[model samples]
Target: MNQNEAVQQNSKPRRVSKKKGKALNNPPVKRLLLPTVVYLIIATQIPFIVTIYYSFQEWNLMRPDKGVTFTWFTNFIKALSAPSFYEVAMNTLILTTSVLMICFVCGLLLALLMNRNFVGKGIVRTMFISPFFVMPTVSGIIWKTMVYNPSFGFSAYFANVFGVAPYDWFTQNPLLAVIFIISWMWIPFFMLILLAGLQSLPMELIEAAQLDGANRLQQFFNVTIPHLVRYIEVVVLLGLMFILQVFGEIYVTTSGGPGFASTNLSFLVYRTGFQSWDVGGASAIGVITVILTIVMMLLMFKVLRRMFKEEQA
Candidate 1:
């Protein structure tokens, strides 16, 4: 065979191999991902766009005769100008913050406890996680009637034993009641995440810290906490997102009363659109809520990232 003919044969095999390599590397990834991307945009973004469109128009279901009219920013202005808006905003902040803090502390403690070996540990962990599996509305009802009820409930029974009046939780402390109920439901979620982080932690580090004259608290604060920083960030951010949108607990327990005392932005949207029949106002409030959530999450992410960098440093 001629040298050129042999070289051409080798070159052809190399070219074929290159094509195979490229196919493996690319793997039709875009084709596989396009359906999911399209699905998400249709499910989430399209509705949001429709909401934004409606927010710019005045549409009251009660006054269908007047029909929808483009009023630019009037709906936003009206929604923002309402006195209850600020109160509801504050309630949302307070509820989310309180729940996140409560759940974090409780979850960390539970995770620490669960990380230890003990008899029936699996059963104990299952019991702890059971609340998270319960439906939100069911959890609300359970707390409202079984735990927080002023009469013939745990509160009343305990109050009787203590020789004090059963506190009307939903009436006098509606926001607090909502906070407690939400914390109860979400604490397990944080526990599972934090527990996973704890389990993944290297025991050698703890032993090394101990050899260096570190106590349990010192090791936890210095070694364990720093190690679990990423997990903590994930738990806090996820908790913030879900807790901020809390509606079921408030609805079942306080009904956003006494007179909007326990109402958060989510419940406010429901009340606006459903009760008041003001679609434009509700859409505007929803848009404001989405904006606020995005801003808050971005700020939080920046802070967490900075903290993570510091931990790495």
Candidate 2:
């Protein structure tokens, strides 16, 4: 054989190298996600665990020397047996349920109205959404001092017009007053969510309903609302979480009274932890609040899942 032919025959087979994946899947990717995981654990998870632990103990800032030794549900039992606890629970549920209803109905109305072609659509939408931006503390004080104060508020002005007594807001009706303030603050959020949901819905369905002899009310009930059911449910769930945990409003307006009238569970926790200085009971309430929020979120997720499944099937 020629030398050139021998060299060609001795040539090694070509080996192909596999492509490396585009993204790293190990510590680098995890390094990016790790901060968030760490934050969640530190900011939320660990504190929650500590709260649960403290719930079963008896500790007050007044007596730090006294370690938070476990008392095994004594605080929980005491909370239950407190007469005001029952009243406050009822008031809390009422505030949660009523304000949610008001927000839903009024918000849906405002959202539907804004969905129509209006000259000042942008302004109206902004106005509707503005209240949600107000922090709870600011909103609470604003309502208490500016809007509901019998001496200087709109109520007082109107009372003068009619030559009637200037009725006190928080003093006379604490539950209703707090509910109105909270509802006012939260309605904007509801409106924005529902309005977005309504806008995203297919117009063809609405037109089809109209063509099928459905009047305005009929179309709204049969078409628009059915499309918004999940959105509304989610909104209500979120609102319930907020309302159940309302404290700033109670603090600013009623201070949990005229007599525990506006004292929701959150305020009860605050009162116990700070005013009465019972950290253990406060921790128990915190644990309960977390559980309530979790349970509500779970229920809402189930509802959304069922809705999704029905849509898919």
Number of the top-ranking candidate, with lDDT as the measure: 1
lDDT of each: 0.90, 0.83
In candidate 1, stretches whose alpha carbon ends up further than 4 angstroms from where it belongs are 1-26, 303-313
Q: Kindly report which residue stretches of model 2 are placed more than 4 angstroms away from their true locations once superposed.
A: 1-18, 22-32, 64-68, 307-313
Give every collision pair in model 2. none
For model 2, state the Cα shift of residue 236 in Å. 2.3
Best by TM-score: 1
Model 2: per-residue lDDT, tens digit, 54-89?
999998887888866889999888877889888987
Tens-place lDDT per residue, model 1, 1-313, is 3567667756654554554687765557699999999999999999999999999999999999999999999998998898999999999999888889999999999999999999999899899999998888999999999989899889999999999999999888999988888888999999999999999999899999999999988998999999998899888888887888998887888889999899999999999999999999999999999999998888897968776666544
C-alpha positional error of residue 216 in candidate 2 after TM-score superposition, expressed in Å: 1.9
How large is the C-alpha RMSD of every model relative to the true structure?
Answer: 7.7, 10.7
